[model samples]
Target: MAFEEAKIRFKGSISPVITPFEEDESIDFKLFKRLIDWHIESGSHGISVTGTSGEPSSLTIEERELVMETAMKTVDGRVPFLPGTGSVNHRETLRLTKAAQEMGADGAMVIVPYYNKPNQQALYNHFKTVAKSVDIPIILYNIPGRTAVNLEVDTIARLAEDCPNIIGIKESNKDFEHVNRVLLKCGRDFNLYSGIELLCYPMLAIGGAGHISATANVAPRQVAEIYNAWAEGDVTRAQHMHFAMMPLNDVLFRDTNPAPVKAALGMMGKIKPVLRKPMELPSKEIQQEIRETLMQYALVL
Candidate 1:
């Protein structure tokens, strides 16, 4: 697809797919592709991998590229592949992002440099440089909760103004006022996406293009239905889906993401809930909560 077409299509419930691992810690490419196919067949709007949900930090650079390559081939252009290609290291971020572009991804989502804590000006330069490195559409990822530093609204506006390819952002922030300001400053057409599950509907209500929600990994159809219902002008149906998903959303985040999410998938017999070392499975309490919630959703018997 052309850049404009891909940018326009890069909306709705884009599932940030998880990277399934075997008990021996090898990447389960087969199960991973199955999950991607499941998301598409179940009506998810798009597919993404190697973001927070996919445990990109755990994968080697080559592995991330392989995942991106595998995902695009599996998708076969049915949906846009918007993979996270950012790392704290600038060179690695550029390299992976360029790789994603070469692999024909619809867009590349690059997170703010974490741990290093660069100021706003530094943030602008970082994003501008990455956006220029390749012609692929760039979606800025701002998750202040994990990254320690927020990509202030001014910096976001600056990047949007400076880089034509820097088209959108995935805001995982909880501050309502801040997000509102982002729309006003960056312009309503700025393809804003809510990375936070609770704010998905609210973000769309304010003219957001869509979301990169992790919850979509478990409840793909329901999540996409929220966007589909709203897009079809059924506000009531969209709101119902929003509320219906609240319970599942809460339980999934009962522990740090991906953990609870991965465990839930394991219970559904999708893949083993194995995480890399230092990032273990959710606690037993969290697991029980996930199990019960999955039952409530009828995702598992």
Candidate 2:
């Protein structure tokens, strides 16, 4: 779809899918494809690969590109495919984003440069350069907890004004005011997606486009339904779904990110629970918590 069409269709629960790996830490393309199809079958509005939940930092550029390729090919226009193509290194970010554009991805989620801690001006230049380089829609990802530098509202507004393709932001910060300012300054047309699970419903209530959630990796139906309920004018049902997902969302982050989420997927027989180096499986206690939580939700036996 064209950027104009994609901007409208990119709303709702877009799963930042976990990158399934084999026992020896090899990318499991076969299982990865299955997960893509499963997300679609389970009502995910879109699929996002290689984001935080997908372990982008661990994967090589080639691996990240391959995951994007697999995701696009498997999705095959069934729904929008947005692959995370950001990195601490601008060159790598450009390379991955260029690949996504070439492969026909609907949009690209470029993260704020991590660890380097660029100031507002530097951040502006970094995003502006990338946005100029790509013809596809660029969704800025601001997770200061991970990236160590917040993409300030003014900086975001500047990019929105300067780069038409720099269309949206995935605000993962806990502060709702930041999200408000971005939308306020950038205008309602600039897409905003909640990266925080608990804030997903609230974000939508405040005019966010949708969410790109890790919890959706295991509960695609519930995540998607939150948006569906709200959109269908069932505020009561939407609120209920949001609260119902609280326990599961807590467990998914009991440990660091994809570890807990991947383990949950493994327990549900969706994929192997292997993780790359420096990112191990969740602890036994955490695993027990996950199992009990899933069981409580009837996500497992």
> Which candidate wins on lDDT?
2
Clash-forming residue pairs, model 2: none
Candidate 2 achieves a global lDDT of 0.93
Give the range where candidate 2 is weakest over 10 consecutive residues by summed lDDT. 1-10
lDDT of 2 by residue, 161-191 (tens): 9998887999998999899989999999889
TM-score of each: 0.98, 0.98
- Candidate 2 clash figure, as a count: 0
- Per-residue lDDT of model 1, residues 20-137, tens digit only: 9999999999999999999999998888999999998899999999999999999998987889999988999999999998888888999988899998988888899999999989
Residue 8 CA error for candidate 1 (Å)? 1.9
How far residue 108's Cα lies from its native spot in candidate 2, in Å, is: 0.5
Query: Candidate 1 — which residues are off by over 4 angstroms?
Result: 1-4
Give candidate 2's error at residue 16 in angstroms: 0.4
